[model samples]
Target: MLATRLIFVLSVVIGWTTACTPSDNSTSDIFIIGDDGPAPAETSGYFINHFGLLTTNLEVMKHFYGNVLGMRLMFEVHVTPEYSVTYMGHAQGGRNGTGFQTGTEMYREKNNLAGLLELVQFNVTDDSLVASTKRTNTFGHVGLIVPDIQETQDYLENHGIEILKRYGEPIQDFTGLIPNAFGLGEYAGAHIAAKKALMEAQGVIGIQLLLMVADPDGNLVEIQQQEQPAGAV
Candidate 1:
């Protein structure tokens, strides 16, 4: 069913085309046929390397994702006196005996690790560079798979992390939160209702238990406990 839906969506996208004359160095109009465009030099072996978050406070974000969420600190680098980057992930092994490396060592073994979350921080005290509060209608959320949903919820609650949505909670109304694009804003209520129905159905099947919590920077983090396969350990 999922594959069928994906194929239908892809077919619709590929069948549609738009003609536009870009105001660049081009002299002719181009018809964009879905994802068709100039071929890249290397067209294969591509994957999502990592997700990066611009943080106001690196230490606070690190403590939230590391100590609270159990992601290991893979590496950290202080690029300059006012700038730093930190990588955290579920991958095992780090450097020295501290279970993390610094500097350029992480790039050497990048292929061996996956699911890294990069946190970048600029230590300048400029108010323009920092947001006073989190943007509520930004990117959706980062999802993490956990072994026990109830336990994860309890842990996050104990840590005083704000719980956006608990298990079996009704999907909140996001009428104006969604951007008014492609007529999506008008159907926000219907969309949320559909999502809530799907969630209830999935929960009845015991396939997944979900919890959504806010990180230190008010970013949403979805924690899910999925049913393991038979004899899986």
Candidate 2:
């Protein structure tokens, strides 16, 4: 009887120790409590094609991005007398050996181009229908990478583009360009101050050079110099 009791105690101790020990499985290996089952198969061959912007003046935007920035016009569609859409990108031609064209042909070959800028315009006569001036309250800015930042800066200056902030300039110098820099509620004021402090710190540490310019529509555009990797093509 003593031998049987000792064996039972040992088995109970072993079972308790095993139950108390932490799992060796990884966090991902552990199944979620409410998960239905395995995740569905992911869709393939997906890529970000382009970013669109609604502009009050399409021709001016076109001239700034296409002529000044040197983005090739991939396609242009005049949907109606007052409504139009234009797609522009850095690429020149399609995969089918055909040059970029306007209207239907360009629409058909649009899938071949990536990183495009789509500008939409609606020339409505009603004051209520027109969009207000470009506001930084929602969308921040559009970023464009250039081969040489200095040359690009000089080119923009020559074209009379408003330089909100030049390369290496202190954030304090361009505070006016930021909306509500002076006036903000309590939380927003603190947030902006913190962001400004961080930006200044980064600038002092010699981070990547950045140039900011305002387009004809007063939309901010960030310009950065492209840095190629060691073995990049």
Candidate 1 lDDT by residue in tens digits, 1-233:
98875665454333331223345635432232366775676966665667888887788888988788766676788999888888886543322234445334455566666567899888885753322123333355677877777887888889898776686564443443211211234444568654434333332333234567667766667666765444222
Q: Which stretches of candidate 2 lie over 4 Å from their true place?
A: 1-41, 92-108, 125-134, 179-187, 190-196, 204-208, 228-233
Off by over 4 Å in 1: 1-43, 93-108, 125-138, 175-208, 228-233
Clashing pairs in 2: none
- For model 2 the local lDDT of residue 220 reads 64
lDDT for model 1: 0.59
TM-scores of the models, in the given order?
A: 0.58, 0.63
List clash counts for every candidate, in order.
0, 0
